[model samples]
Target chain A: MKLLAALLSGVLFGVGLAVSQMTNPAKVQAFLDVAGAWDPSLAFVMAAALVVSSISVVLARRRSQSLLGEPLQIPAAATIDLRLIAGATLFGVGWGLGGLCPGPALAALSTGVPEVWVFTASMLAGMLSYRWIFRVAPIRE
Target chain B: MTEFTPVSATVGGLMVGLSAGLLLLLRGRIAGISGIIGRALSQPLGDGGWRLAFLVGLPIGAAAVSLATGRLVVEVAASTPVLVAAGLLVGFGTQLGDGCTSGHGVCGIARGSKRAIAATLAFMTSGAITVFAVRHLLGASS
Candidate 1:
């Protein structure tokens, strides 16, 4: 049941990404390009997503167990430390360079674009390297 | 500029939110791609079934959309080297930061985490600055 639910959610999320054209790196870059010809479509994506998820998050917060009787796994770390700031800044620069974040990149894989494959491969390498170097388990947040 | 797609974007956003909500409500999991992928890579031994199912569903769902719509437009403007660099940064940085746009931007914001908010601001600002440098200063075509 849990696996089915996760699969369903993943499908829905991917559909959303493709439908919104968030899978398009050029569109994402345009949205980030404030000084250039800016497209505000992605803003609506974020706003609308927030409206729905905020309620869900709030409701989930009030409960210890999920509707499936699984323990709630929402992240509890609230520290605004150097790691968060530096890491996010670095990720942002990379996002601007390629305009491909993880979710959209994964969704775009279905497009059979060679660059998408390259990016995804390199991204995985980077991730594994981080683990290799730090030897720390990836955080669950 | 790309064609503004407010309607599709909004609808898609709602769907994304619904997915996140459902994952949280049903499985008690945050729909964070980086965290999901990261953990799946790190801990491939136990509890890999749901993660694999979810990951597989992403591309399949996207393919379903492409089939239904006849086309899914995706233009990656970055060159191979740039993409490699970008991918490395994103992967390593998300691992270090503990979240990406979906985790921090969507779910974390919804939960009103100060860390997520700060991280979002940092990324957004840096993203804009990077774009400015690349497009405006570096004279790269968008």
Candidate 2:
């Protein structure tokens, strides 16, 4: 049952990526191309998504546990430092160039574009390196 | 007269929100792409089945949609080298950040996580800056 639910949720996410055209790297690039021929469509999409997400969070928090009987996991830390700045820089530069992030990249895998493989491979490598480096001092769980 | 039927962005938003909710509910996991793929690669024995299925299903779902609705137009405006570089950088960043946008922005922020909030802001701000620098400072485009 849990497996089925996970699969269904993934499918739903893919469909959303498709319907929103978030899967298209070109559209994403256009959105990023703020100085040249800026596209506002993605902004509208982001705004709409934020509205839905904000409301959903407020409502979901009323309950102690989620529907599946697990407590919602929220990040504990709030302080910012060198680690935060550097990570954001890397992510931003990547997004500016690659035009796909983890969510859309995974969703794009279904599209069979060769680019997905490249993105996925690099993303995995990055994660692995993180694990190895943090083996002795892992990120707070 | 009135032929325009607006596809509610809310439908997709709701789908995303619901997916996050369901993933937490069912698997006791966050629907974070980086974390999911990371775990899938590292520990074959750690929650492997569903991760494989979910990752595999992504492409298949898109393919099925293409077959039914017609091929979704794909265009890579960036050069191959640039895209690859971007991928490597992102791969490195997710490690440093400890989570991707899905983990921090969508799932974490929704759960009232301050760290997620800070991370998401940083992510967005940097993304905006990169675009500004690349398009304006560097004068590169595709």
Candidate 3:
């Protein structure tokens, strides 16, 4: 049942990404290009998403366990540290360069574009490299 | 500029939010793509099934939408090398940050986490600067 729920969630999320036209790199770039011709469509996406998720988050906070009896595992880290800033900045640079974040990138894979495959493979390598260098289990957020 | 898609974008955003809400309410897990993939790769096999199921569902959902709609728009203007570099940066950075747009931008902000808010601001600012540098300063074609 847990797995089914996760699968359904993933499918819904992917469909959302596709419907928003976020799977398109060009559109994402345009959204980011504030100084240039900025496409403000993505803002509406974020605003709408925040409205629904905020209510759910508040509800979830009141519960110790999920509806399925699993322990709630929200992120606990709260510090605005250097690691967080640096990492996010790097991610943003990459996002600007590629216009593909992890979620949209994964969904865009269905287009069967060779570059997407290459990007995905490189991304996996990058993740693996972080593990290899740190030699510590990544902190779950 | 890309065509503005307020209606579909809002609907899609709602769907994304619904998915996140469902996962939290039902499974007690954050619907963070990078964290999901990273943990699935490094963790022991016993608890990895759901992660794999979620990952598999991503592409399947995308393909399903394409089949139904008869079109799935995607354009990668970056060269292969550029994509490789960008991919590496994104993967490493998200892993290091412990979240991405979905996790930090959507779930974290909704929960009112100060860390997520800071991280989102940092990335958004950084992304805009990078775009400015690349498109205006560096004179790269988009």
lDDT of 3 by residue, A1-141 (tens): 888998998999999889988888888888889989889888888888888899889899899899999899988888988889898999998898888999888998999988888888888888888888889555757
The candidate scoring highest on DockQ is 1
lDDT of each: 0.90, 0.66, 0.87
Number of backbone collisions per candidate = 0, 1, 0
Better of 2 and 3 by TM-score: 3
lDDT of 1 at B123: 91
The residue pairs that clash in candidate 2, if any, are: A110-B59
Name the runs in model 3 displaced over 4 angstroms.
Answer: B44-48
Report i-RMS for every model. 0.9, 4.1, 1.0
Model 2 chain A: worst 10 consecutive residues (lDDT sum): A132-141
- Pairs of residues at least 3 apart in sequence or in different chains that clash in candidate 1: none
Best by lDDT: 1
Clashing pairs in 3: none
Q: Which runs of model 1 end up more than 4 angstroms from their true locations? A: A137-140
- Across B21-131, the per-residue lDDT of candidate 3 in tens digits comes to 998999888988888888887863546388888887787778888998999988888889989998999999988888889899999999999989998998888888988
Q: Which ten residues in a row have the lowest lDDT in candidate 1 chain B?
A: B42-51
TM-score ranking, best first: 1, 3, 2
Candidate 2, residue B98: the lDDT equals 62
Q: Report the TM-score of candidate 1, chain A only.
A: 0.96
Compute DockQ for each candidate against the true complex.
0.86, 0.45, 0.84
